[model samples]
Target: MRLLDNIYAGERVSAADAVRLFELNLTELGAVADFRRRQAVPDERVGYIVDRIVNYSNRCVACCEFCAFHADAGMIAPYDLSFEEIIEKIGELVVGGGTQVMLQGGLHPDHPLDWYLDLLRCVKTSFPHIWLHSFSPAEIVHIAILEGMSHGEVIGRMKTAGLDSVPGASDLLVDSVRRRVSPRKCTRGQWREVMLALRDADMVSSATMTYGLDETLEERVEHLCFVRTVQDETGILQAFIPWSFSPANTRMCEVAPAGGVDYLKTVAVARIVLDNVDHIQAGWLTEGPELAQLALCMGANDMGGVLTEELVVQAAGIHTRLTAADMEDLIQNAGKIPMRRDSRYQELGHEG
Candidate 1:
């Protein structure tokens, strides 16, 4: 099947398409997908950037078997960021020319919904112009359950408290798989409901899939189809970000790790399948810096972030950090222009 025709069909390509995508010469696949994206979004140029992930709390009850970042219940000192501590972090972020804040953390077992609300309000009231791109669907569901609030009400309160958007982070969007992997977190249906609610409220979010962890290729494609189906319903999902599952200190896949070729192949298929989503972000955090740079040529336009600090993937034992200048260098090294961007991909400026 021709790439353009496959894209125009506006449907999820079959497993055969995924296999074909996998078999294509890497350069050939890159050229075809890049060309298609250009035709659809002509004015867009390179250099999509998001700010650092500032994890405020490490305490969590959702002790996912796949996670290495969750603090155990018997830890000596579990610190939640005091308002002043959070403000200090934000002060550094702003002065460093950061544009957005990705505030995610473990599900602090005992904190009230108001605890999150107050922190959000403090950040927004202090820096109203900064994009507060925070929270995942799992966190939302957990918070709602803890607060005894409906998902919609939780989103409303969050928006009122200053949430600019959600991260769409319900990893492995298939229920049977999730039930085995992250049973304590939000189920697939619950995650979808949360995203639907955010979409209904006119918020933009990005969907993600972390593969290379006990799921077959069919399951991977199924996950892509699920995200596309949601996009068809709500039309508010902004991007699709597929990251390889990191098996560092996690209980699952203790020795197996996702390779670069696998990562690129997944990106190629994602570009072919998720025709509705405008942007595809390469997870620089999960796949090292070099692979992330290579991802630009392999169908990913956005190299995820100028992440000043990130602990989620780091705790899982992958440490590939990049500054704003470093990202500009990576884009240039990949032979594409790097254009600095905000949460919505509005070109704020160019770094190089």
Candidate 2:
């Protein structure tokens, strides 16, 4: 097949066409994938940072069947981190050398929009340097619906209140699929609308995909195409991250996680498909460091972050934790430069 020729020449292919490219053996695939990576990001290398995911609240209204972190409606111990408590967590993260704080949480039923705005302001006020790269479009949509406000208004208010950027958790961009898993959540159109508003306001963010559930390969490609379209339209995507769905504590535990081969294949296809995006982030949290390192050869330019703390995945079942030094070692062992990056893809530091 002329797959490598088209990919190297920067031609988009359909998902059906892309699947044929994955049929090649590991050695051949690795060579082509590595060549593509070199072509895309030559002098630059994949980077990651030691950061923490301090989920402020687990009480959720949009209970996704695939999510294991959402607490039940009457579930007690669904603690909301007070301003003092969150500040302490940020202090610890900063002292531990974490430059970013992934402040994610569920859609707390009663918390006003000011609750989140106040949280963002408090985080920025307490630690002026810590990047509060928090919240997903889904969460924003949920809040807007509850507050009886438009998506644009909620996102504008949050951006003014000091949200750094959106997290890549829009999941499937198709509503039929999302309804199967998360009926109560925002529609796909709503999610995209929220992201569009954020982009229009000049806040760039990352996009993500969670595969290996009920979605087909064609659907996955559709998701990628949607991302590419949005990136082209908005010009605000910093990276693309594709992760496997972990069915641990979720209602969909019967569905198996995506295998390493499938994960690498998707990453390779993503590189070929999303030609406009600058970076492709491989999920070490879901695929482990070894497979994540292998993804570097399979066209991924970012090794994601060394999460000092995580909940969504932990709630799912996988536990692959690493330090900044460990991430450096992984990248070095994989024969790629280990550069540290801030929330944006700007190189913050480098290590051997």
Candidate 3:
């Protein structure tokens, strides 16, 4: 009762309290989270984005254990998308009414910083209106290492090259889990440095958490608290996205995927604790439409993106897709108005 009272009084849920909240009955837990959600977003509208993901290359050096997406430097044939190929993809997105494009790829050992800059320039110069939400912190760190520049310098160059925003990806955000999942990736400090650099550059980004690996409940809270604290200090995170770790078709196939109920509880807890973060997204690309709908009742206010073209999670053997109409219908059925938005959560239109 005290926990519920504190939450209702608008007090921030502590890391310890957040972990304790997990032990409550799932339905009750969801209700408390829903109350917080209503407080944050009083409007009956839920947001969705029409977007596509374009992989610039498949060659990677930081081969994470949980990822089934990248082709190792010598293990498989590598492919890099040419300017013509990427332009064709952007053309497809424009034809589909997509206003945003997610540009991401693994760290290739050969490509210089200019190559990445050229890719961003090619898209932004051609489609000046499209939002280029590209690159992860790890990717930024890789570019900095290759170019012998500071993180701030790399971000400045990226912005000048037309990079609009970054996806909160890579590094588990907890050093223990990060070492377990992606040892070759950048450290937690390195990732945070990149984020601070983004904030200094006056750019926006989303924060993400991939749970259900070897992390404990307390560790999960730590991940959320870390991002919440960062939001308090930087004020640059536009949203928060939490998804389950896909364990199939990777070196961690022996591990089981997190159940649907766990995903719901996670969404609820995220809303309860991340008071500073405005939006909490239901990762429908991995959670599917039905589960994502239920997540709306729990705390999620956004349905992520339409994911016109996605490959990373698919490579992990979890395949799901949805159209703009499908997403709108899902939100309507969940008793919320469906709003089409861009990466910045600015509503483009209400009609599909």
> Would you list the rank order by lDDT, best first?
3, 2, 1
Q: Candidate 2's residue-wise lDDT over 52-139, tens digit each?
A: 8888888888888888887763323567778898889889999987898888888778989999999989989888888878888878
Q: TM-score of each candidate?
A: 0.93, 0.94, 0.97
Q: Which candidate, 2 or 3, would have the higher TM-score against the true structure? A: 3
Lowest summed lDDT window (length 10), candidate 3: 70-79
- Model 1, range 233-291, lDDT digits (tens) per residue? 88888888889877776777464887888898788778777778888887787888788
Ranking by TM-score: 3, 2, 1
Q: What are the RMSDs of all candidates, in order?
A: 2.3, 1.9, 1.5
Off by over 4 Å in 1: 1-12, 73-77, 253-255
Clashing pairs in 3: none
Error of 2 at 108 (Å): 1.5
Lowest-scoring 10 consecutive residues by lDDT in candidate 1?
70-79
**Which residues of candidate 3, in runs, are more than 4 Å off?**
73-77
Q: State each candidate's clash count.
A: 3, 0, 0
Q: How much is the lDDT of residue 29 in candidate 2?
A: 72
